[model samples]
Target: MRPIDEGMPRERTLLSWRRTVLAFSIASFALARLALAESLTLAESLAATALLVIVLIVVISMRLYRGSMSAVGVSTFIVSATTFLLGVIEILLVLKD
Candidate 1:
């Protein structure tokens, strides 16, 4: 059993993270606008705020995750999972409203 090449895999992972973060940020902003336009309830507004915060955190994490081996995977997983969860929640909220 041979270990995989470290550099290429890491680079690909980083690029994927970058694309995910960009998509999350853009989707959050779009949802925020939709929520604002539709006069969302306080709870919904708070959810949007949470999504925005997650976007910011993910963006920042990308920078910090670049070279730190120990923390990179943790940050990437958190961002990716949160992004998917938030997207689902947003869709449900919009439909519920």
Candidate 2:
């Protein structure tokens, strides 16, 4: 792989992944807390499950692609798109309430 400016690009990429994981962690905990407080509707429960699955996918992909920049980038893109989709699902849940 071509090195770029003393690994700044790599650092940024890792940081982005860290941010995504942290955000997903927060969302997962929130969902868990909500689930404990009251019964969630089918849609909400599905959303929570999907969110968890996406989190696992992201974590696994990141680990698997640690040595490959292009592979990690593709995984990041997929994870990002799914995260946005989850956000939309959350919005719908709020609207339905």
Candidate 3:
């Protein structure tokens, strides 16, 4: 049987991860739009790659969250941080015009 309070924290964490995914999706869409407007092939490719990485991170994060593994949670946080950094880089590159 699951503890009563456990669900609350887990649910909150999951919601935060979902928000992260949504934010990344919006950023990726904006980057794509900017890339298309300026004919930036490299920016487009980098943004796509970052978006894919974010998707992969979200998948791993879901698994980690479900399993309640602290070790994997740390790894997920690291992956999310790196993915965010990559997304920032993509945005910067796209705006470097």
Candidate 4:
């Protein structure tokens, strides 16, 4: 068996978190564009943009901290779940109209 590199797991975890953040950012931008093109009011758009910014900031912080991979995992799940729900809601709204 090959000797394990102690830092490899942490490096992989951090890279996974970065990829999660990138995916979430893409999804958020798509949703925002859909909202702006469809039925979102200016106030609603601003609020959503603010929330996305805050979430992104937190995720980035978790990635940079290096204290705990748990924090990164949890934040990644939160962002992914939130984006999925928002996408579903937006689709429903679009279909309803």
Q: Please list the C-alpha lDDT of all candidates, in the order they appear.
A: 0.66, 0.63, 0.70, 0.63
Q: Model 1, 1-97: lDDT tens per residue?
A: 6566656776676677677666766776666666666666744774566676666665665566565445666665777677776688678767888
Worst 10 residues of 1 by lDDT: 61-70
Overall local distance difference test of candidate 1 = 0.66
lDDT top scorer: 3
TM-score against truth, every candidate: 0.55, 0.55, 0.63, 0.59
In candidate 3, which residue pairs clash? none
Clash pairs detected, candidate 4: none
lDDT of 4 by residue, 1-97 (tens): 7756566876676677667666766766666666666656843674577466557655565655566444656665666677677677667757967
lDDT tens per residue, model 3, 1-97: 8787765887787788788778767776776676676667856785777677677767766876787555665666666686677677666765786
Q: State, as a TM-score between 0 and 1, how close model 2 is to the true structure.
A: 0.55
List RMSD in Å for every model shown: 5.4, 4.7, 3.7, 4.3
Question: Which stretches of candidate 4 lie above 4 Å from their native place?
Answer: 1-7, 40-65, 68-77
Model 3 clashing-pair count: 0
lDDT: the better of candidates 2 and 3: 3
Q: Put the candidates in TM-score order, highest first.
A: 3, 4, 2, 1
lDDT of 2 by residue, 1-97 (tens): 7765575765576677667677776775565555443455654665567677666666665665465334555675777776786677567656766
Off by over 4 Å in 3: 1-3, 68-96
Name the weakest run of 10 consecutive residues (lDDT summed) in model 3: 68-77
